[model samples]
Target: MAIASVATEYVFSDFLLKDAKEPKYKGVRLELALDKIVTILAVGLPLFLISLAFAQEVSVGTQITCFTPFNFSMKQAVYVDSFCWAAVQYQADNSPLWLHKFFPYILLLIAILMSVPAALWRFTGVPYLSSDLNFIMEELDRFYNHAIKLAKNLATLDDRDAEQDSQSALDLAEGCFKYPLVEQYLKTKGFSCGLVVKYMVCQCLTLLVLLLSCVYLCYYIFLASLVDEFPCDVRTGMLKNDSAIPAAVQCKMVAVGVFRLLSYINLGVYLLLTPLVVLAALGPARQSSSFLQAYEMLPGFGALSKFKPIYNDLSIYLLFLKENLSELKSFKCLQVLELLQQSAEEGFDTMCVLQTLSQVKTDVFDSQKMGSITNICEMDKPKN
Candidate 1:
């Protein structure tokens, strides 16, 4: 176990080295089961027990059911209870109390509060997991597409999984890449360095959240988890004037047992999530090394060699006239036009986007994305 933790840290530290280097091409992704049941179990059990403690308090109902002077009426009994209680200034033994009291509830409340950040993070943060997988999946699909396009001009498929799954998931994810904002988000400048960084950051956030939460829970747990046993000054307030009262009183909190149980559960979950938080920061590059490498190679190669960019600019100005020129389709024609236009004219400025577009290539169109893009593009189309 210790070795595994060390290994996890080692893997993360290794990432720091790569942060400064060019990313490699090894596209992997993380897929974990999302059973809200497990999440509920992790967070819910403690709260449920806290509730159960409340229920017990309701059923029993008194802090210390002392036999005050029988002469006292119910209200007077409460006062005597309150007075000595006030004098003792405490409760939690002899009978029941939490019926109206709020301390343990507050402690339980704290435990529940501690669970909130992690709970929200798990549910909200991880739902994105499926989407994230879709992201890599789309990226992989596009890589295949570009490979296929380039492959047509080149020889065999370089990547193993490419040629096969080509029609499989891509078929299902067809057009899934149309408006790949998430993928774009993954790659700031067509590089997913930000994705890894964001991932690491989010992990740190998770760790900090959990760590802070654990601190809260630990304190509450320490307070609540205590055997609920303590001593208090029995003769304070008015009782201070009374010599009959014991100088000091023994005080044992009633719900510590329940709070202890709650704390144990909270502590356990926090401990478990702590490492996952660490992994989140470290695992991105390893997970999507393939995609990163693909994205990284783009800027280096995405630029205009010379003529194409120049010709492309002239083509844009004579956009109407250029429509007839199918010559652009052949790379050889561009050189003949030899920088006829400025470098900006003939080049592929759209390469980065087109490339990223190519990376997320899908066989089919994302019905929804297709419609939206069509609607938007139709709106953006030049007025003829």
Candidate 2:
């Protein structure tokens, strides 16, 4: 067992050195799965639609087709298509028809705008939150390990040793298991409302952009549906006096059908994302109580409501933990510590507590092994 332990520690140290430049908390996600899903779909959908729209344009060969007199040659016909496309924007009567030419550009703009909120959060919020969360997780790891070891030590003590050293043992347990690092970190950060404000601003921006995109898509599809063919007056510039060039030629925009389809698809997705953004924005506020209640049973958990700033900060921390719950090992550590805290308070038998703590230690170790395996798999993934 000792040899195995040494080998395991050496391998872990080597892995750490190999990945020294990478983030220590690379497994931790900064955003919720919901946020990632919404951001990906919202931003990716437009880009995909733009590519499809452009592909349709390329496949069709030309965006505008104009009718010419029978006397006009093939070159003249090509000129008509080219001239109508160039002057598609200048035709005041068919202004909405111009959108068919620039539909892909519009989708590109929406994609860039949709991505802004995510970029804002990444730049403005991630650094502070990441450091704080990593620190809390590191401390939780230490605190839980200490608690489990203390439980095992207490379990092995004979009746005489336990009785004689009861005071010292209890003092050791209290010192080892007490909240210090995380609590102190939260206390120092309690007064800061910057993270909350930054988070809200990003969510609100996402909501606003989604709403606007839906509205614009609705308006665009309506206008596009009304006008696919428009009259193009090609008798301008040098051909002003040429009566043979026909006064007004009817031109059809070939790509309008594709644009309309893409618009409907984009609109449907944006509508779906709007509600999700609202839910994400309201999540921290609505769910803070239930999550924070778990920590209430632990020691040093003062009357949180009395200290509003501290409570808010703690809520923010729990919110991040909730976001990263699936990947975070610290959550299990916290659960074990909470159980230990309860056992100590209820005056449980040392042996019974030890049994419970052993199960917890087993679970924690199993989770850590799984996490290490997952990290290895992730590291082996080909870098983009």
**Candidate with the greatest lDDT versus the true structure:** 2
TM-score winner: 2
Root-mean-square deviation of Cα positions for candidate 2 versus the true structure, in angstroms:
10.1
In model 2, what is the error at residue 354, expressed in angstroms?
A: 2.8
lDDT of 1 at 202: 41
Give the runs in model 1 whose Cα sits over 4 Å from its true position: 1-43, 63-77, 80-198, 212-251, 289-384
All-Cα superposition RMSD per candidate: 21.4, 10.1
lDDT of 2: 0.68
**Taking the tens digit of each residue's C-alpha lDDT, what string does model 2 give over 1-384?**
465345434433322212236556678888878889999999999999888887887898888888888999999899988988888788776467677777789889988998999999999889888888888766654544454455445445555676767667778767754655655666665566778788889899889889988988998888765688878787889999998888988889888877888899999988888889988887656644344444444344434334342324565676787676655453554555455545343333433432333233424445554344434334433468
TM-score for candidate 1, please give it.
Answer: 0.40
What tens digits encode model 1's per-residue C-alpha lDDT throughout 1-384? 465335434432321112114332222222222222233444565577667767866766755444544454688556554554443323435332332245446545545654554455455544544344444444434443442343232222224664565455455344543444433443432322333343344445546656775785676555534444344444556667876544544444454455556567767876886665554344332232221222333222222112122112122112211222222211221221122122222232322222122222233434454344334334433367
lDDT of 1: 0.41
Error of 1 at 352 (Å): 33
Each candidate's lDDT (Cα)? 0.41, 0.68
